[model samples]
Target: MFFRKTVPVALLAASVFAISTPMALAAGKGEMFMGQFTTEHGTTSHPMGDVHARLNPTTHELTYSIHWSGLTGDVNAAHFHGPAAADQEAGVLVPIDGPYTSPLKGKVQLDSQQAAELEAGQVYVNLHTQAYPNGEARAQLIKH
Candidate 1:
């Protein structure tokens, strides 16, 4: 029901987490994901960015990093929106706080439903800016 990516970063993190977090190791290997953000996918053409995320199935922990560039205005907000197909839009599933600057890093523990949706590649990361109050850039989550 879960697909694990044996990327070096994931493997290395898994080893480290294994030492202090046996449950994480026992839960299983982490799944790696990538998202390429662009204005074309959003409601308007005003910003662009990239997002990286890892999900530890056993722990329900979602670790993420986002890099944004070419923003037309200040980043007003960002979130992990979900359960939508590539061509559709959906409600917010997780709120992402900042270091509003580039290379944002954080983690959130997901609920069972969210975890399932993530594993099924139904979630996405969206960056919003003042110019595009709705959304400036968006990237659909997909297992890497």
Candidate 2:
């Protein structure tokens, strides 16, 4: 009887501690942001897609998923361009891994500045193709 009671109490204490630990140790979790990619939104008009991304400030990781279609030709490259406002242009900030195909999923480790840019809605994902070397489809990342 004593062993049974002590075991149950210890387990209950352990369970309670585990549950509360995460909350107390929680870091600054960021928000999930999304964007609709389209040709008109880009510098050209040929490709379209959607982008979903989130920046985890605690880990300094940016996770992204993209689905694209209607690309004029084979995808040549894709990247996250940054520090540009909507309808404006900027340089590439992060190069996405290629053989670029639809429903792409990837993660990138971002620095403090990049995380700040992402939170500020200054980052955009752009897809480049044979026809449009600049950008075929683009979308501005916005915090939701």
Candidate 3:
């Protein structure tokens, strides 16, 4: 009786661990980042937008999706600027390839420094329009 109960309990525990291990590993495989854009965050007033990004640390690939509307004018340019605080500005770390329309989505591989800055929450997305050549809206990426 003792041997039978021990075998069943051991098998059950092993099965539970096997099922849960992959889930735990998958959860830890990547990090998510998000941001909300507004004229308030930019150098000029225009409109609002938002971004969602995922970073795979092992592969150093950053995938992102951005959406916006009602800006002062058409989008002239967009970029990811980094290694700076929210109130400060920095040079572009990544240039968003265009048509420069809304709901932009893409992926890029990051260098070590860029990956570090992104992971540290020192990165931001900026949208520029014809009216606000500097920036129409901005959102700082925050890790989740």
Candidate 4:
């Protein structure tokens, strides 16, 4: 299998996505999740979108997929935030190191503690950037 570490950046991103297919098939179907984020703009106005996710329990990792319209800028970063409440979601558990392209794709490698947070239903994913000083979009996560 070609991991990002073994390939050129362009090739790496491609392979990362390609590898997921079989890995997806081998593992039990991951839980499907969806969320609505208020965003830094206050979740009260303008345009926004949803977040999609799949968790690989065995790897203790989560794939966050974000899609939005009228996003002010390119996606600068993505993250998993939480330890908050149902409508009061909190901080970030993982900082997605990215120069993310559209769809703002990335992987979050969770340690035992992060995994625990997710299983506890206290985690979510968010998209951030310059234009979206607060946030461009967000999706609160829940196991399906």
Index of the highest-TM-score prediction: 2
- Per-residue lDDT over 1-144 for candidate 4, one digit per residue giving the tens place of the 0 to 100 score: 577556687787898889998887867756666777655546443446777777777787777777676566677777788775566757778887766765666777888787777777787777776766556676667777
Provide the TM-score for each candidate, comma-separated.
0.76, 0.81, 0.77, 0.66
Q: Candidate 2, residues 75-141: lDDT per residue as tens digits?
A: 7899999988887889988889976878889998888888899899999998888888887888899
**What do the candidate models score in CA lDDT, each in turn?**
0.83, 0.84, 0.86, 0.71
Number of clashes found in candidate 2:
0
Candidate order (lDDT): 3, 2, 1, 4
Query: Evaluated with lDDT, which candidate comes out highest?
Result: 3
Model 4, runs deviating above 4 Å: 1-26, 41-45
Residue 67 C-alpha lDDT in model 3: 94
* Candidate 1: residue 90 Cα off by (Å): 0.4
Model 3 clash pairs are: none
TM-score of structure candidate 4: 0.66
- Between candidates 1 and 3, which one is better according to TM-score? 3
Q: Residue 126 in model 3: shift from native, Å?
A: 0.7
Candidate 3, residue 81: how far the Cα is off, in Å: 0.3
